[model samples]
Target: MLFGAGAGMLAGLACGGGSGDDARPAVLAHIGHDVAAPAFATLHERAGALVAALEPLCAGPDATTLAAAQAAWSEERDAWSRVLPFGFGPLPPELNALDFWPVRVDTVETAVAGAPAAADAGYLGGLGVSAKGMPALEYLLWGEDPGAALTAFQSEDGARRCGYARALAVDIEARTDALATAWASEYADALATAGTGSAAYPSLKAGVDEVINKSIDACLTMVKGKLDNPLGNLSGAAEDPSLMESRFSGRTRADLQANLAGVWAVYHGADLDAPAAGISVLVAALDPALDERVRAQYARTVEVLVAVPEPLTEALVADRTAVQLARDELDTFRRLLKLDVASTLGVTLALSDNDGD
Candidate 1:
């Protein structure tokens, strides 16, 4: 199932013929406009809402305001998860800024202690990645318990702590807004007109290759970075609950579910029944049987993930089998994309820095 083995098998398979070539422009257009653009828009909107919620809570640290802010953060986090498949364009540069995890509590606490009373964007800009993204905000909002988080906000350092959280939210909103604007104003054209005087891509094949390869990388991220690390698949030691994403809010399961949904959006479409021109169009045209298998495997993977109990930190200890089953299903999904679908599309798979065998 390694990519080296997949590349060897690809040498014997035929390239996706002229029809797939002809469909590239439409597919790119659909993905650019119908899929990526809207996803970023939602993320931007949700980030704005997060800022709004955080403002009132920072001004007055109360139970109701805290709940509202936490709910807003969850919504923004899910919106972000859905856009995880498209790692190109304006995403890569801002990825760490927007969602860096395994949050360093010491960094966040130190930053908060030294932050100005106002804690604006400039102050946040000077801080490191670990102290200012979604994870940091989750720690601030949820803490060890809702009561403790509220008590801290009402303590002598309450204003500084809340101000720092608000600053982080503001930074996230600005970044997401820039991402949405970039995709809509310029990057979409680069993708849609690829191979037709589009400087970003030399050929339609190259454009499609980027899309399929990113999808593969996203799957790999979910399988390894998100699931395997916490499950101790990489360390070959005891499961480490602290490695889980969204651990502070107990939303790790929701995050993984949203990630798989994002991958499915690329493989199928935004809609399953009436399908838009996602990579699925070219994939189905080039190899229908493989398409069906991918579709089925994706469903199986999501189903198993949903079955994993909530608060993935505890699940890693109590329900390790369910989590591992979900990971195995996701690995299979990644293999099908990296091996069969990429070969069918004649895509040149690019190596990702995070990729492992």
Candidate 2:
């Protein structure tokens, strides 16, 4: 609502709404950059894969047991494979359409309970009850019984049951991966089998298309992860500073600043061309004038995002629900650095758009 201010008015400028005018353009510029099509598309694709990958991490036990079980199940899978007559081995076309979410839950539950991560994992108390229990389950118990009403995934005793469930999930993952690998193999073999754009070109093209489209989806998710996603929905596990020390190590503040730069570049044009300078400016401004309390809150939030194990996806999908809220507040504090969008020719000019937003 107010606008007239200068460096000489710093004291009153900080106290009154005079700063809002300066802030508005900066915020808008940030929004434009943040939500730009290329950035958004890149992140959206990545987040989709990350959500699928990390969702299974907390399941339990370890990778070793899960692998063993999957190996055994593959033998059985062959039986299913042989009975089919379609291209690329015998997997149920109908089941393949069930989508990854179904398979994701199914697989993670299987791996965690079998070994390395946990002893048991289940939904609906493992009662096999399709109703009355929440559709998805995430629970971990340490030497305690959750009682009969709850689906129990016991380590030693329950391992037998949980192991099989875990195995089933691992089997599903393998089945899917196998399909991709087989397609790639065929593509590669065909490349040398014939001349360019020959009889096998169509087959190779199909495989390439499938993989590229899949990658594009990952990129789209990455954009979403950067701009959206939230902290609460990510993991139930509590923060562990020791783990943080192990993973990030040394200059925590610097690391945090780098993260800000990455996020900033997407929407704020925080100098992708000059990352260090952008991060330095952001950190300097953030530390002194911004509310320390709020800064600390945000700092912790970023910490969680970094630890997420998903690949090609930003670990921030959990925050998808709260992104609007964050953006609304962030709109107040957004800042930008001005730079020339120079033409390839030697001509240089100052555009009025130097909002320094």
Candidate 3:
């Protein structure tokens, strides 16, 4: 679930305590109650809206209904993007079920051909990763064009596609609802109780370290998974467009922005509304100058992302300079995050073991 950026810098705020003050407990509480719980709530709500939006489209398969469903999908996806920064514990499994990309098209095709009785949660949940989730929905809704997809849904065999799409939405809704419940009830306590007489973590520092680890992973994903790999930086040619996140919808840029939003959420310790004590406060207390540098870097990264044109798949090929510029700027931010923020906070990043780009 962890991803990164949003507006309003979390820097420049004053801290009452000096470098020696330990605010990990407070930070964890704020993240659990204000940040993670609320993000899951929003995800559940938006997912519900998507399920409802898809109902009419599946039944009628018209352009108007298809458009409505697409809009709902974009909203739900943005909500999911904001939720990415907390992609730890239960979130990762749910994310794999919901947004795993480069979907196994053949698997999905086979499932649709079989035509299950209903697209209920159990049925969809039992299906393979590539055969279900948002990516599959993207394939169904945006295949060729909305109009053509709708026409296919109206054909003699259209019921099968409609059934699968409905099932996918229902499964997503179920997973999000389960996530919200788990975070609010079970995981939030574990996070809030981190470092204090807890078996899960030895110290409050451990909890904070988890946040740092996820944040760095989000930054790494931005630099490597999202941009460089797809752009073919190693091979000296852009890879297939299908490699890009949000490739079906051409909203990869928005996904990148949401990545930053997740980072912003963690940096600020809360979302825009609930600004409780966060890593920023700890960093400010320890080294205010370093804090300012990290914030400025975050702002610069957001600015670079803002400048990149939409439809990132095309941007990778035709507008290589713009994509490269954004990537370079994000790389700088990632380094600052690793060097200054993590160092000053006394945390270490555990880079992924899997070496493939």
Candidate 4:
């Protein structure tokens, strides 16, 4: 799971034997242009929508408005989760600013109390990770009782919370825009031109390998961090939903679902926007049976996740068996990913820049 240069089975996979080498450029292009670019673009758009939705809620705090804002946050958060697994090039520095979880509730409380100006991205960005990202917003918008939060927003201190929330949303919007612009203008080329003496990635395979590893890491994170860590999948351990991502918003289940969706996108080399010639095509060409197995397992894993109840933190205690079942399913998915996918692609996994993440 550690993010270092990938070796192991992928290094042993035979390479340079067929048209596989020739397919690298097309695959890289698909990843940079078709896959990554659209995710960022959509993220940027969704972040903007989130800000717009927040504006209404801030101006008039109520249950209906709060619900609308929460829905918007989920939309933006889903877009962001899809893009997070592609953590390379121009992404790492911005990730924490986007969604640092297990958010410091105290820091967010302080920031809300201070109610700094909302127009300043610099000021917003300088705030602690917990105070400026999605998790912080989750706390403000949906804490334990969203009704109470709504009431508070309507109270005298409502302005402070609303103002702070606006500032955070503005910061998110700006960061997403910058990311989209960077990928479109520069980072995409860095990935597409990898291996042509590119400093970031010595070879196209290295670029592809980095993404593949990130996808694998993303899956592991879902299993260990999102699911098992909170569910206490280990024997005789009590579950702890408090450790779950987006617990304040009851979004833990949705986050893993989004994570799985991201992994699928990375494997197939496509996203919500368009389909691209991806590693799946190459793998299918190389080994149809392995490709089919991976596809089936990936689909099944997502299904298992979808079948798990929402507010996964609660599901962990109420129906721990379901959580364990999902964990087992993810374990299978991870093996096929870390072992079969890497071997078929003839690319080794490496440490992501956010390695050990």
Candidate 5:
């Protein structure tokens, strides 16, 4: 769902804390709650603007570099747009790099051989759907015109087995991991190509990954809490009446608005309570294999990239003056990058992980 630039930028502003404070944690500081379906629509418009801006840069950074950038960008942006009806989660950076951006780059570099590109996109799409939860439920639960929309989403009758409402969560949770593995398999050769260390893409990748991990945790922690369903299923509520009220009884348009205020406070460097459901669920599903992959991805970005992203590697070993100059230049580039969408469309993207379940 996309709106005009104002709607999209407003939605972007409604996201995690913006700036002015260096002491604040980027993810925890913002993670806004004021986001709604409209805001969610706004978000996509803004991201689309970003994708449009990145098109030229995506092309100039060499085939392999562009491939990686496009992969991360596509994964993040597609997942965001695809999951609209359900709601939104912050687009963490790492997942964007590993799964989405490469595919995007490949699409530009080699669209004729789309088989390869599709695989990469499919894989990240799978991974992303696996991770989406709250957005799914938010739409499933309250994304309609109070009575009519609510009944339709919740209705379990003919013509509405699963509506556009929790499909994303189902896709991501059940089918994504395998699909992502396949995406990786499809683009093995292209993905294997070494990228020039100069593209600051790796830093962005690291940031995206961190944010995804945190969001995963946040989703897990929701269990038994307001949004909790032990199995983390979007359909869990539709199946069990008690579960729905227990989790969302107190929730409303106003509550989400209030939560956004809390998110703003975080940006301002205020202490905020961690989401009980999100984080807990994520940790529960963590495995040694996934952990290893995450580490390797982190290492690859930090070790190979020129930028100084946190958590991917150690302290910067570059010349201090040169690094400062580079940082300033990058900042300038970032500022030049304004988000604007060609057109805005309203579509209900169901965010669910019930693909298998």
Candidate 6:
């Protein structure tokens, strides 16, 4: 039961071309080469820039240097967010190692205190995921207060704190570099050649299903984990700002937008009007109206999300209505992909680890 009764009826009427085997290879190639490879490369490049920016801040803690480092981190975060849809390849194993969120303040603080004066990769490798990655770095770079953050870097333990931050940046740089290399050198080909001798995907449907399932997972992450938890929609309790992601840096909204952008990239290809190849190609070929509906729904979701107030943490308490509106829109978008589009493709929906209320 991948679809509901209504969705099954829609599938029966819309899914005229069977499993869309003929259009899969082109879509896979477009996503692997054009969308994912470039995104990971940009992430790697931004990771390097983050390291470069942090070096100056670690050397001399100043307002200008700190701002530069924060900007660099934001760029890297955006790049990482845009690749959220491509959860296969080298990404799955390294996921937590790269961006574990709801960052534990105590864990990071302990690591900063215990770390060597000059923390390096070996030292960072011994630390837990809570003490490293983008979220941890966000805590280090932009703590509760901007002035206090700078003063802490200029205090007695400044060297150690800055050293730990540098080490985290290096760890991120290494991981992103490896991810980009793996995708460009090997995984891209494996995905593009799916069902035609690629061992990763035994059939064309497997590859397409992987893409669709990951997209659905991304949506679920936004609706349930990002929005619902923060809004306290999962529990019977009131809104909990602490549950919000990217709260330290106040970039939760940007992160959600980037997640949707990644999904859109998978659906519409690199460009919207003149797509090279995307899931839209297969869907439009089978049912043009469904494709149009998906496109419109995606646009509506983005629009509502943009209307929500910034610093999603505060919005969860003060502007809950706007936030809930955005969440509802995202759930609608999720249903379109999970039900209509998946059934139309004859794709068997797979359960992701993130799948839940």
lDDT of 1 at 186: 82
lDDT of each: 0.86, 0.30, 0.77, 0.77, 0.28, 0.86
Per-residue CA lDDT of candidate 2, range 287-349, in tens?
Answer: 333334334444554554444333211222433334334433332222211111111111122
**Mind giving the per-residue lDDT tens digits that candidate 4 earns over 1-357?**
413332322332335322333666677778888888988999999989989998889888888888988898989888888885788778899888787888787888877766564535666655677777888888888877647678878988787788888788888888899999999998888888877766788776677788778878887787777777777664347787778888888878787787788777767878535543777766765567988998788778878888888878778889888888888898788878778878777767775332232
**Candidate 1 lDDT, 39-88, residue by residue in tens:** 99999999999999988898898999999999999999999998888999
| TM per prediction | 0.93, 0.27, 0.89, 0.88, 0.20, 0.93
The worst-scoring run of ten residues by lDDT in candidate 4 lies at: 2-11
lDDT of 4 at 273: 50
Off by over 4 Å in 3: 1-21, 235-237, 271-276, 354-357
Measured by lDDT, the strongest candidate is 6
Can you write out model 3's per-residue Cα lDDT over 1-357, one digit (the tens) per residue?
Answer: 212211111221122222223466777778778788888999899999998998898778877888899899888889888877787867887677888787666787787887674656666656778887888887787764536677778888887788888888888898999999988887877888886665565667677788777887888888887888787875677466678888777789998998888778888766456642667776776577888888888888899888888888887778888998999898888788777777767675676743232
Quote the lDDT for 299 in model 5. Answer: 35
Q: Lowest lDDT 10-mer window, candidate 1?
A: 11-20
Candidate 2 C-alpha error for residue 303, in Å: 13
Task: Write the residue-wise lDDT of candidate 5 on 23-100 in tens digits.
Answer: 112332132222222233443443444344333332333334333433433333343332222212222332333222
Clashing pairs in 4: 3-351, 4-351, 6-349, 195-202, 195-203
- Model 6 per-residue lDDT tens digits across residues 246-347: 887888999999999999999999776685378888788667899999989998999999998888888888899999999999999998999898988888
